[model samples]
Target: MRSLKNAFAAALLLCSAMASAHRFHAGITDISFNARTGNTEIVHTYMAHDVEALLANLYGRQFDLTDPDDQDVLRKYVEGRFWIGGQDKARLPLRWVGMTADPEKVTVFQEIEQTPLWKAGAIHDNVLIDFIPDQVNTVNLNEGNAVRTLTFDRNQLEQPTR
Candidate 1:
């Protein structure tokens, strides 16, 4: 019984250590064009802790996840890191909407107006890449009825969103 208890305690400690060391470094972005509104909507989702860590490193200050000022800072940071281009390779204008944060995650929303329907475009997403070397950012582009996925990592920074 003593040996079994010791083995269980050791296993629990190992699991806790592994979990702390292997935090996931990733984020997901969803983009869709609204025909009725004539706008392209973009939503980016990230882990709250990861975003807080980023804010601290970038601004040299601690930020409350639910604070409005902190959220604005996050919005500006995300907008600067994310970019989209049309078929002509001209940068599309992005209008920041807002962001919402819960204990688990934070989601930021933005929009680009007057985008043509079903047009091919490209996106450059470098969110969290500067802070985390292994960060993986995945973008999902939704057309009228179809959805396409693009993945960006340390090796590949941008991709076509067709």
Candidate 2:
């Protein structure tokens, strides 16, 4: 009976430790067409702690996302990892709109002017996947009343926009 109690206590302690150490590594991206602007806008949302950890791992130093230079670094990194291809398989000209960061979350804004959402053929989003193997990204395609979703992970980085 005493041994059973000891084992139960050990299991409880182990479970608590594992729960405290585990953190979710995920991001969400939204691609939507704006009729008023005649553009396709993209927005990415991620955990602020995860972004800071990624920046620190890449540059070996902490980054202030509010600073232009730091934001540019993150922009370049994101651009290289995520993009939309045209029907001809050519990459679209995705302009960086900007980004916002608070204590808990980081939001990035991008847009392609004069392009319809249906014009996108393929999407490649592997943001933070290289740095964190467990990272996963979900892209939501919002077109009119219909909505579609594509998930990206370490194994699947690119997928047809349709």
Candidate 3:
């Protein structure tokens, strides 16, 4: 009975340690054209805890994502890191549609008015990758009944939308 108890305790300890270790850093972004609105919409989702940690490390303070100032800071960081280019290689005018956050995740919304998804020449997404070496961002492009996935990692940051 004592041996079994010890073994159980050891297993619990190992599980706890594994949980404490950072397992993965990842983000998801979805880009789609809204036919009804004639707009190109973009949504990005990231782990809330990871974003909080990143903000704390960068600004040396805890950030309340609910605050406009804090959200703007994150927005600026994101804008600098991620963007979609037009066929002319110029960045599309992406308007920030704001963000929502919960304890588990943060979701950001953006849009390009009157632009079609097919007009997008390239995509650049490196959000959190600069801070987290192991970060990976997956972008899903949704068109009429079709979905294409592009992955951004340390090795690949930009990809053609075509």
Q: Which candidate achieves the best lDDT against the true structure?
A: 3
After superposition, candidate 1 runs with Cα above 4 Å error: 1-22, 117-120
Q: How would you order the candidates by lDDT, starting with the best?
A: 3, 2, 1
Candidate 3, residue 125: the lDDT equals 90
Better of 2 and 3 by TM-score: 3
Q: Candidate 1: global Cα-lDDT?
A: 0.85
Per-residue alpha-carbon lDDT of model 3 for 21-49, expressed as tens digits? 77899999999999999999999999998
User: Which residues of candidate 2, in runs, are more than 4 Å off?
Assistant: 1-22
Residue 17, candidate 3: C-alpha displacement in angstroms: 4.3
Report lDDT (Cα) of residue 115, candidate 1. 76
Q: What's the CA error at residue 125 for candidate 1, in Å?
A: 0.4
Candidate 1 per-residue C-alpha lDDT over 16-110 given as tens digits, one digit per residue, 9 for 90 to 100: 99779747788999989888899889899998888888999988998986778787888788878899987888778888988888877989988
lDDT of the candidates, in the order given: 0.85, 0.95, 0.96
By TM-score rank, best first, the candidates go 3, 2, 1
Candidate 3: residue pairs that collide: none
